[model samples]
Target chain A: MRNILAIIERELRAYFTSPIAYVVLTIFVFLSGLFFRSILAQVLQMGLMSQLQAQQLGPRAMDMPGMITRGFLSTMSVILLFVMPMLTMGLFSEEKKRGTIELLLTAPLTDLQVVLGKFFAGVTFFIILLLTTWIPTGMLYLYSTPASGPILTAYLGLLLYGLALTAIGLFISTLTENQIIAAVLSFGTIMVLWLVDVLANNAESSTSKAVLTYLSILSHLDDFMKGVLSTSHIIFYMSLMLVALFLTYRSIDSLRWRG
Target chain B: MITVENLTKRYATKTAIESVSFQVEKGEILGFLGPNGAGKTTTMRIVVGFMPASDGTVRVDGFDVFENPLDVRRRIGYLPENPPLYPEMTVAGYLRFVAKIKGVPKEKIGAEVKRVMERVSITDVQERIIAKLSKGYKQRVGLAQALIGDPPVMILDEPTIGLDPKQIHEVRELIKGLAGNHTVVLSTHILPEVEQTCNRVVIIDRGKIVAIDTPQNLRFQLQGAERVFMEIQGPVPEITSKLKAMPGVIDVHTVGSNDGRHRFQIEGELKKDIRSDLARTVVQSGWGLYELQSASMSLEDIFLKLTTAEERE
Candidate 1:
């Protein structure tokens, strides 16, 4: 337990000591802020159009807070997809590149401690990233009364979704010593899983479509965004996270043998 | 104490170390001497639990490295050829982290880091970032990292490679000082380092140990005959012939000449002391005896001889 925290502390310092965390944070905040303003403007436009239509037709009610919550949740999910690789790309790759992996491997700490330490470090950074979004979401909560249930459920789903992606990035980082290669490979991999939904729609065979749709990384996310918390969707992301973490553990084991 | 038996590491392309076997006694400084690419690093890696041997058993402090790795690792400290350091961390910070991971208690981490830093004489630069430090300082920090937790055994690979001469001298002294309390296995291509620091030397060549012996014994065993170098200011052929006539002297030849003084290399029978006889013969013959000194085989020659002897076969 102490060894794991030691690793976690080292990793966190590594993240903040370098410009990686700041640059990723700034870009994420900037992009998310831009999307927030645009979504707010669209919501205002929709409210205006409905108000104008209500004077001519019968009275129609518009859920402004709900619209804002759903819009912000969906946009935040895509923004997270783009930024997660930056958070995890250097986890094992930098250690391998600088030859520090030997220190960890030769230390008294078990491989599981090291792996979980890194995974938790990445998760903690992802949580920090999630908290940054609260600035914009907090503005929504202050200006209007949005139902807290869907927003919290959506965030819970997004955290699971992010963990699975982080596991992918962490596993890929273990495969190579080059951070750029790790980043590009992880981005390409996550992109495929994200776009599987499109492939599912275009499939000619019903069974093939069903399998592809089930494999799509975003379809499960869509249910969470809609506030429909199904056990199967949660299970899918959990299983993916578990499998990726297991592969990362095995990769580290093989690295020791191959060394 | 560590024992390695039939250790071999075979990659897909070639074997790194082939059936290498050696043991390090408690409180012994074992110098692993080898040329570059001679599997010195590979053997140390396997011993330190940095990697696994293809077919072998490494028992460290009564625990097998492959089976009870944590037990073995707890007792050993390793410094690789390249210092395994996080460049962004401070020297003190890095040491503390290492101490923590090595299982030092939280209360003692402060003192452990300080102890290692003072041991390596890096306490002044403890606050400085590792990457900004010079190569010599970085090497010292790596040395300090290994000293943390005060493990029973230390494996240092080319510990003085990047340091300046003064730093190299200090590190050698430090390793020498670590003998009784901490068993050390240091690898190097520098022969003089092995001579000055190690109690026993393992000379590895081409992924195998060619020779393992005390420095003095290796020199004695490899030296076929006792040799004496002399500078005589007299007739070169006369001095050579006169020295060759001595009973214990096996052969004599003129080596070089300058300032009217000729250098003669006299080879005597094994374990014979012919320096006095050679000196007397030159002095009595009215030949000026400028210089006389015995020249034993240096470790460089033994290293070359052993490494190249395999090529001849």
Candidate 2:
């Protein structure tokens, strides 16, 4: 456990010492705040129009805070795909490029400790970036009553989503020594998974659509955004994270033999 | 103590190191002497658990590397050729991280880092970023890294490379000082380095060990044909012919003539020292023997003979 923490601490320091962390954080914050403001404007305008229609008709109902929260969070999830790769591309690739893998491998620590340390470090950074969205979300609670329970579940879902993305990036990072290649490969891989969701919507065959949608990471997030937390969606993200981490463990072991 | 038996590592296209085996006794420094691409790094990596040998077993401190790697790793400190440093990190931070992972007790980690930094004489630059340090300082930082946790065994791959001459001397002294407490295995293509620092030398060539013994013994053993150099104040042809006539003399070649003094290098048969015989013959022949001395084979010649002589066959 101490070994794991040591790696985690070093990894965090590496992030903060370099410019990648600050650049990714700045871009993420700017984009998420922009999305949140636009979504809040759209919701408020729709709310105003609904109130006008309620006077003309009998009455109608709309959960403006839920709409705004769900819209803002769903947009933030797509933004995560763009930035999570930057967080994880250097996790192992930088080690290999600089030949620091020798230190980690020859140290008394196990391969799992190294992988777990990197994994949690990436997840921790993702959480830090993900938590920034709460600033915009906090406005809702201060001005009006927003359902806290669904917002908590939404954040949990996004955390798991980030974990799954981080796992994908972590495993890919181990396969290459070039950080740029690792980043591009991870981006390409996650984008493929993202596009699978769009393809599922256009599928002619019901069977093919079900399979693609089931495999889509974005499909699983829709339920969490809707405040409908299902066991299957949680299981999907958890299992993806687990399988990718298992691959990372195996890749690290294979690297020693290859060398 | 470390025992490596028939360690072999084969890459996809080539065999890196083949059937290489050596042992390091407690408190002994073994020099892995080899030229470039000679697999010295490959073997040291295996010894430190950095990589697996395709075909052999290595037992470190009685723990089989395959069966109990962590047990062996915790007892071994490794300094790879590249130093394995994070360039952005401070020297102190890097060592502290290494100490933590090497399983130093939490309470003693701070002290251990300080001790190792001081041991390698990098205490003054502990707070400096590694990438900004000089090459000599970087090499010392690498040494300081391997000294972390005070592991009983140390495997250093070309520890002194890229350092200035003075830094090389300092590192050699540091490594020599490490002997008798830490069993050290250092690889180098530098011959005098082995002579100066190591207790035993394993001369590897082309991924195979050509010789293994103490420095003096290797010199004596490979010096089978004794060579004697003499500068005789006489006719060059006469001195060469007269030296060739001596019994047990294998070969005679006159180096040069300066001021009517002839310089001759005479090769004698195995286990024969014809310096006395050649000197007596010169004195009796009414010629002045200005200088006469035996030239022991240098490690450089032995290395060249062992590494390159095989291809001639």
Candidate 3:
């Protein structure tokens, strides 16, 4: 455990000392802000008050705080697909390129510790970047009453999405010494999963389409975004996280024997 | 203490090392000498547990390398040919990270890093980024990282490969100062470095051990008999015949003639001092002995003969 934390501390310090973390955070915040403003404009132009009045909804009909938070969550999730690869590209690839992987491999720490430490470090940084988006989301409370449940659920969904993608990125990073290749592969893999739902919708059988949709990370994330805490969605995200991490560990293990 | 027996490593169809074996006692400095691509690095990597041997048993301090890798790793410190370093990390930061992974206690990590930095004379550059440091300083930092955790054994692969003459001397001195405490296995293509630093030498060639002995012993074993090189102003035939008839002389051959002066290489039996005898015989024969010096086989000759002979076979 101590060794794991030591690796994590080194990784965290590396991320904080480099400019990549700040650049990622700035981009994430800017995109979140842009999406928030566009969502607010569409909500206001829809004049939701009349729709709620005709449906005998309360005076809180104009309160589209849930929709605003959902918009931020969806945009952040998409943004994460880009930012995660950038964050994890150097985790193992740069270490291999710089020959520092030998230093780590020869150390007393197990391969699992190195993989977990790096994975958690990337997750921590992603969470920190995600938190920066919440500041703008929190401002919604000042203008109108907002339900905290949906906001909290959306945050949970974003966190899971980030964790799953970061794991995939780390796995890709372990596959090569070239950071550019790692980044591109990681982004490409995440994009395929992100769009799997669109392809699944055209399946001939409903059951097959449902199975494919369930396998898509974005499909599971939709549950959390809508304030539905489904056990299956939680299991889906956790299973993907587990499989990605396991594959990463195996890749690093093979490197030790083959490198 | 380290022992390697019948180690073999094959990469695809190319064999890196084959049936190579050697042992190092406590506090012994073994120099691994070979030309480039002679499997010195491959053998060192196997001993250091960086790469597994295709077929062999390596025991470090009585722990089998493959069976108890963590134990072997804990007791061994390795510095590869290239100093593995993160370019963006500061010297201090990098050392501390190495210490952490090397299993140094948190409280002692700072002191350990400081001590290694001072030992390698990189204390002043601790705050500087590794990428910006000069090659010599980077090598020192590399050495410093290996020295962390104060392991009992150190495997340095061409520790001074890229240093200037002055830096090489400095690193040699530093390594010399580590004698009697650290069991060092240093591999290099530089023959003199083996003579200067190692108490024993292991000559490897084409993935095999050609010879393993002390520097002096290797030279002495390869030298057949005490010979002398002499230049004389005499007829080549007369000098050769006269030198051959001497009591102590075994054979004399005219090696070369420069400006009417004949240079003859004379070989004789061991324990024979033929320099004075040859000079007298040349003088008495009415030939001026311009130069008469004993020819000693250097370590370079022994290394070349061993490695090149293996190539022929």
Candidate 4:
């Protein structure tokens, strides 16, 4: 446990001391802010038009807070797909390129300790990124009344989703020593997982469609967006994270032999 | 103490090392001498538990490297060919990190880093970023990292490869100072480094150890013939024939002739001191002996002869 903390401290310092952290934070916050404004504008205009229609016909129900929060949270999830690779590209790849992996491996620590330490570093940065979304969401609280339940659940969903993505990126980082290759390959892999949902919708057979939907990385995320806390969805995300981490552990073990 | 037997590493494309074995007694410095691509780095890496050997057993302090890796690693301080340094970190921060990972006591981390920094003479540059430091400084930082926990065994691969002559001298001196307390296995292709620093040398060629002995013993074993030179004023053919006739003198030839002085190159039996005999004979034969000098084989000659002679076979 102490070894893991030591590695995490080193990894976090490595992230924050370089330009990569600042650049990534700035880009993510700026883009999320832009998408938030656009989504808020669209939500307000639709709500006003619906209110006018209700006056002409009969009273109708439209949950403005839920609609806007869900829209904004969904956009944040998509934005994460683009930003996660940058955060994890250097986790193991940089270590290998600089030959610091030898130092870590030859130290009095196990491979799992090194892998977990790096994984948590990426997750910590992602959490910091997730906190930036609260700024726009916090603005919603001051101007209008929004349900706290859905907002909390939405944040929970984003956290789990981001954890899964980070684990995937960490595994890919172990595959190569070049950060550029690691980043591009992680992006490609996540893209395929994201597209699997679309593939599931077009499948003609029920069994094939069911398996494809279950395998899609985003399929488990929809329930959390709807403010539904289901054990099945939580298990999906947790299992995905564990599987990726396990693969990373095995990869490091093989690297020791292959070296 | 470290003992390695039949350590072999075979990559998919080719074998890096084959049947290489050696032992280092406690408080002895063993120099691994080999040219480039001769598996010097591979052997050290396996011994330090950086990688496992394909077909051998390595016991460091009685713990098998493959079986009890953490036990072996905790006792070893390894410096790879390139210093494992993070470019963004300051020298002080990097040393602190190494000390932490190497498992120095929490209270002693600060003192340990300071001791190693002072030992390597890098206290002045402790705050400088590793990337910006000069190559010599970076190499010293690498050495400092290895000395962090003061492990009983240190495995350094080509530690003085890129330094200037003065820095090389300092590093060699520092390594020599580490003897009698820390067991060291340092690899180098430079001949004099082994002769100057190591207690024993294991000469490797083409992924195999060709010779293993002390520097002086290796020279004597590989160089079968002894040579001597003398300048004399006499008939050149007479001197050559007379020198050749002496007991244990293998060959004699007149190399050059100057103003009434002839220089003769003479070869004699191994382990024989023929210089005094030649000098006495020259003065007795009514010849003016201007100079008499013995030319023994240097380590360079033995290295080349051992490496190339195997290639021809």
Candidate 5:
């Protein structure tokens, strides 16, 4: 456990000492603020039209807070898919490039410790990125009353989604010594996971469509965005995270063999 | 102590090191001597548990490398050929990280890092980023990391390969200082480095152990003919024929002449000192003996003879 923490500490320092962390953080925050304002504006415009319609006819219920929060978070998730590759590209690739993986492999720590330590380091940075979004959401608390339960559940969903995506990015990072290649490959992978749902919509066969939709990462995230708490979505994200981490462990083991 | 038995490392299509076997007793400094592409790095990597050998076994501190790698790794400190440094990290930070992962006590890490930095004389650059340091300092930092946790065994591959003369001297002295307390296996192609620092030398060529013994022992074993350089004021033909016909003389050649004196190098059988007999012959023939000196074979000649001579056959 101490070995894991040492690795985590080293990895975290690696992220912060370099320019990559600051670059990713700045871009993520700026994009989130832009998305939040636009989603808020669209929600407000719809609310105004609805109110005007209610004044003309009878009153109709529309959960404005639900629509705004869901829209903002879904857009945020898509943005994470793009930026997460930057955060995880150097996790293992840099070590391999610099030949520092030899140190870790020769140390007393097991491959699992190194893998989990790096995985947690990426997750920790992802959490820091996720926290920045809270600055925009905190503004919601200042002006109007949003449903606390949906906000909580939505944050959980984003957390799980980010965890799963970060795991995928981490796995991809182990495949190459070039950070750019890792980043591009991770982006391609996450893009496929995100676009699978679009493919599902155009499929002619019901069975193929069902399989594609189920495999689509966003399909599992939809219920969480709608403020519905379900065990299946949680299981899906957790399982994906585990599979990615397992592959990372196996990949590092192979590196030891081939070195 | 480390024992590597019949170790062979085979890649997909070729062998990196084959049938390499040697032992480093407790507190012995074994120099792994080899030319480039001779598998020194591969053998060190396997011994330190960085990679597994394709066949045979390695036991470090009595723990089998393949079966009990963690136990073996815990007791060994390794400085790879490339130094294994993270360029972005400060030297102090890197060493601290190494100390921690090497399982030093939390409270002792600070002192341990400080001690190693002081030992390698890298204390001044402890706060500098590793990437920004000079190559010599970077190499010292690599050595310092290996000294962390004070492991009983150290495997250093080409530790002084890139250093300047002064730095190489300092590193050799430092490695010499490490003897009697830490068993060290250091690799180098420099012949004098082995003679000056190592208790025993293991000369490897083409992934095989060509010779393994003390520097003196290897010289004695391969010293087939003793050479002597003599300058005499005598006719070239008479001197050459007389020296060639002398007892214990294997071959004789006239090297050059200075004024009226002729220089010749004579080869005699091992353990034979023919200087007295040659001098008496020259004196009895009425010639002045200007110079007579015996030249012992250096480790360089021995290494070349062992490595290349095998290839020639």
Candidate 6:
């Protein structure tokens, strides 16, 4: 546990010492603000004020849960797609390139400790970036009657999305010593998952479409956006994270033999 | 203590090291002298548990390397050919991180880092970023990292490869000072570095152990035939005949002529001292004995002979 914490601290230091963390945070904030403004404009244009009055409630009494959920979920997912690669691209790639992997490999820490430590560090940084967007998210509570259920679900969904992407990014990082290659590969892989829903809609067979939909991260995230946390969706995201981490462990293990 | 038996590492069709075996007792500084591509780095990597051997067993402090790597790693410190350093980190940060990963107690980490920094004389630059430091200072930081935790065994690969002359001397002194307390196995292509710093030498060639012995013994063992080099102001044929006729003189050959002075190489039995006899013989024969000295083989020649002889066989 001490070794794991040491690795995590080292990784976090590396992240903040460079421009990566700042760049990721800046982009996340900009996108979140843009999405919040867009959602607010749409709410005003749809005359949610008069609609609530017709429902025998005050102008601010109507629940804007759907708008809040869609706005937060869509913006956070996009932000995560871009920020996660930056967070994880250097995890193992930089170590391999700088030859520090040998130092860590020969150290007293186990393989699990190194992989999990790096994984948790990336997740932690992602969470920090995700939490920063919550300031705008919390402001929605003042203007409209937003259901806390969907708000909580959206945050949970964003966390799962970030977790899954971090794992995949870490796995790709372990595949190469070139950070550019790792980032590009991770981005390309995530893009494919992002387009899985589109591909599924065009499928002729129900079974193939259902399979593709189940595999799509967006499809699972939709469940959380609707204030419903299905066990299957939770299991799906967690399993993907687990598999990516397991592959990362194996990649690090293979380095000792082939490096 | 470390013992490697029948160690072999083959990568697909290429063999890095094969059936190479050597033992290092406690507190012994074993110098691994080999040319580039001689598998010194590969063998060290295996011993450090960074890589697995294709076939063989390595025991460190009574623990098998493959089976109990953490146990062995806990007792060993390794510095590869390249110092594994994060350029963005300061020396103090880097060493502190190393101490943590190396399993130094949380409370003692600060003191351990300071102690190693002082030992390597890099305390002045403890706060300087590693990428901005000089190569010598970087190498010193690398050495300092290896000394963290005061592991009983240290495996240094080409530790002095890129250092300046002064830095090399300083590091050599540091390594020598480590003798009698840490079992150090350092690899280098520089022969004299080994002669100066190591108590014993293991010379490897083409992924094989060619010779293992003390520096003096290796020089002595490879000095097969006793020979004396002489420069005389006399006729070449006359001096050669006189020297060849001396007691215990096996053969004589005129090496070369310099400024009208003839030089002859006289070979004789190993146990004989032919210097005085050749001087007397040349002087009594009406020849001027300008210079007479015993011909000695250098470490380079011994290394070449051993490695090349193995190739021939």
- TM-score of every model? 0.92, 0.95, 0.92, 0.93, 0.95, 0.93
TM-score, structure 5 vs. true: 0.95
Expressed as tens digits, the lDDT of each residue in A1-259 for candidate 5 is 9999998889889888898889999999999999999999999999999999999898998887778888998998899989999989999999999999999999999899999989999999999999998897888878778888888888999999999988999899999999999999999999999899999999999999999998999888788888899998899899999999999999998888789
Candidate 4 or 1, higher TM-score: 4
Q: Model 2: number of clashes?
A: 0
For the predicted complex of model 2, DockQ is: 0.84
Regarding DockQ, does 3 or 5 come out ahead? 5
- Candidates in order: C-alpha RMSD to true structure: 2.9, 2.1, 2.9, 2.5, 2.1, 2.9
lDDT of 3 at B201: 98
Q: Give, for candidate 5 chain B, the lowest lDDT window spanning 10 residues.
A: B218-227
Worst 10 residues of 6 chain A by lDDT: A57-66
Candidate 1 residue lDDT tens string, B1-313: 9899999999999999999999999999999999999999999999999889999899999999999999999999899999999999999999999999999999999999989899999999999999999999999899998998999999999999978899899999999999999889999999999999999999999899999999999999887568889998988777777778889888888889999998888888888888887778778889888899999989998899899998999
Can you write out model 4's per-residue Cα lDDT over B1-313, one digit (the tens) per residue?
A: 9999999999889999999999999999999998999999999999989888889999999999999999999999999999999999999999999988888989999999999999999999999999999999999999999999999999999999899999999999999999999999999999999999999999998889999999989988765678888999999888888889999899998899899998888988988888889988999999999998888889998898888987687
Q: Which window of 10 residues has the lowest lDDT sum in candidate 1 chain B?
A: B236-245
DockQ score for candidate 4: 0.75
lDDT tens string, model 5, B28-103?
9999998999999899999999888899999998999999989999999899999999999999999999999899
lDDT of 6 at A224: 84
lDDT of 3 by residue, A9-63 (tens): 8888888788988888888888888888898888776665567575785544354
Model 3 C-alpha lDDT per residue in residues B146-166, reported as the tens digit of each score? 999999999999999999999
Interface RMSD of 6: 0.6
iRMS of every model, one decimal? 0.7, 0.7, 1.3, 0.8, 0.8, 0.6
**Model 6, stretches more than 4 Å misplaced?**
A48-62, B232-254, B266-272, B276-289
For residues A132-219, write the lDDT of model 4, one tens digit per residue: 9989899888888988888888888889889999999999999999999999999999999989899999999999999999988877
All candidates: DockQ = 0.82, 0.84, 0.61, 0.75, 0.81, 0.77
- Comparing candidate 1 with candidate 5, which one achieves the higher DockQ? 1
Please report the candidate that would top DockQ against the real structure.
Answer: 2
Q: Please give the CA lDDT of all the candidate structures.
A: 0.91, 0.92, 0.88, 0.92, 0.92, 0.89
Contacts from the true interface found in each model, as a fraction, amount to 0.97, 0.94, 0.68, 0.76, 0.94, 0.86
- Give lDDT: candidate 3, residue B108: 98
What digit string (tens of lDDT, one per residue) describes model 6 on residues B112-202? 9999999999999999999999999999999998999999999999999899999999999999999899999999999999889988999
Model 1 stretches with alpha carbons more than 4 Å out: B228-293
